[model samples]
Target: MKGFFDEVRANLRSPVLLAAWGFMTAMMALAGPFGSYEQIALPRRLIVWLGLTALAIVLATAVRVVVYSRWQLRDFWRGGTVTSALSVAILAPVLRHMAEVAGDAYLIVPPGLVEIAGFVFCLTMGFCAFRHALETVPPAAARAALPMAPADPALPRLADRLPEGLRAPVLRVSGRDHYVEVATAAGVASLLMRFSDALAELDGVDGLQVHRSHWVAARAVAGGGRDGAKMVLRLTDGGQVPVSRTHLAAVQARGWLDQT
Candidate 1:
């Protein structure tokens, strides 16, 4: 349920979604499927169109939440089809009600047919928007190919800061508020140490701070990829670390970016 709301929030903030809604509103006003385009005043036409578009978008988002929660379909196209169909089912009656309120009569086609067509058009637009949103580089697959440095028996002083069992080959160190989360070959452990002090203790380990909050071992980096414009590094332990813009040039200079 939390995930569903999160998805809804994300979708609402998407630029592609906003653009789609704008396009739909314009088309609804200009096309005038239920009446002659010039029959209604421009202001009234725009108001009606905007209202209907908002209603449809809200309902479609709700349908997506339900479909995604109830049906865990892995295939993208198949899942989209089912969700779109369900959205249309919820859209039909609301569209009719809005049309009647706006004093528009179904012109060439029945109200039902118009509603179906409108819903289908909206669904197609949504699918395209999502496809654009999902266009991200796959995680780096070359982590295994990278050579690992010799495991030094002399543990870095940073090991003293970790729990006894977690004092192994550190993969990454991430800052979380006042604590630092240390990921190692053994497992993950959190210690209440200042991030700067922790970095000073790891003097012998070959690693770099990739982000304001993240420091990753050079050998642990599997490869790199792009999530939209942001750079990401895949670690041997199957963790993805985001590279901040401030540190991107430094990471690239080390040949880490080329590995992806």
Candidate 2:
């Protein structure tokens, strides 16, 4: 139950995703009971409209994410605001017409005024979405971005060293303070990094975090064991990392259960 809620929270926390969902919801509300091109039975209309709304939200979220991936957070938010505003403004007619389908005619607002209102509402929603996205970034992310420890009066400076490219590969990414653990042939190495930055750096890697604190290299697993709802990843070096139930299938699909 807790894990389920965490997943829900993570989805809601994404700005581009959440913003797209909101816009899609508004679009559905405008489509009326049966949808854009139909005047079906009341029950059928409600079900179809709701199903399409859900599908649209998912698709819109995916498109926004793919586009946003190439841009920095700031630029993405700025552009997304403009795009969202424009989309809503243009769709006003479709939405208003849908509202008129239930016997009561929707107020015929001037196009100029409707567009202005949409722009303002979308802008506000977009800004709030961006702010929430930034705020959701964990503090440990900052540490991962810069691995160098600052010079301090009480502690001597030490050279930072990343693990040599070994036979074992990175399993997953998780952040805590200034360290990120990479599951490798040797074992888990808690290196200096914020969790978020480390996750971002895993663009080319083929792995996923099985738990909030554990990442498993895709190719390092020797076997697996289970403990109630928790999972254990057995490595070549006799090391094991716990996998949350949430990521159990992902781990198994990576052949974490197969032994050479």
Candidate 3:
């Protein structure tokens, strides 16, 4: 949960989020819905709308993280929908009251629940769309940016499930009965996912399955040779994985077997 709130606070610093906030705040200030254009002075209206939208964006981020963590929902459109709905449900009434204060109830009827929801949802969706666009970098381009580079929030899909400490270069993935264990410089973590699916998401990661249930990054291979009758690949962490007969040819072609 600590990771969750940390993500929310981090959103405030995003260029995309900041741009979206500024755009929405400016639009709201100009349009002056809820009678704020008539009731409040121009400068105060801008300030009030800026504060309102900022709060909404923060709330939407909190809702987004909670939903994803709990339901594992990651679809772009579906996530935006859930985020807007849940956010409106949580913040609409508060916004309506605030809008009334800004609009001055004595002069105008403020804004109804439905009207406030529409305005909030529109701004939230705008923020989400901008964030998604920024994160949609091409896989090849992403790979060109090496692990030594500063940590990118848009890591490989598999990294999303890893603990924060394990964000280093992924060393390997080993499949057990029902989960895949991922190894990184910091440590190892297990994710409840298919071994094949795990390997598929690791595009441009420069690795291959050395056996039916084991994949190793080229950079992580210390060497390879026979441990008794079984051919094995030694890892940087002093761990070893058996190289199966099915993948022996590929491993040999890559010259990994000669590294030892």
Regions of model 2 farther than 4 Å from truth: 1-176, 183-190, 258-260
Model 2 superposed RMSD (Cα)? 14.6
The digit string of per-residue lDDT tens for model 2 on 137-210 reads 23445547866444323211111223322214454444544555454433333445667666665554545677
TM-score of each: 0.44, 0.32, 0.57
Q: Model 2: clashing residue pairs?
A: 143-194, 144-193, 144-194, 170-217, 171-216, 171-217, 175-195, 178-193
Deviation (Å) of 85 in candidate 2: 61
Estimate candidate 3's alpha-carbon lDDT, on a 0 to 1 scale.
0.75
- Using lDDT as the measure, name the better of candidate 2 and candidate 3: 3
Question: What is the C-alpha lDDT profile of model 1 across 192-229, one tens digit per residue?
Answer: 56788888888779989999999999879989979788
What shift in Å separates residue 174 of candidate 3 from its native position after superposition? 12
At residue 103, candidate 1 shows an lDDT of 53
Across residues 87-111, which tens digit of lDDT does each residue of candidate 3 receive? 8899998977766664554346767
Against the reference, the lDDT scores of all candidates come to 0.69, 0.49, 0.75
- Model 2: lDDT equals 0.49
Look at candidate 1 and tell me the lDDT of residue 255: 86
Ranking by lDDT: 3, 1, 2
For model 1, what is the C-alpha lDDT against the true structure?
Answer: 0.69
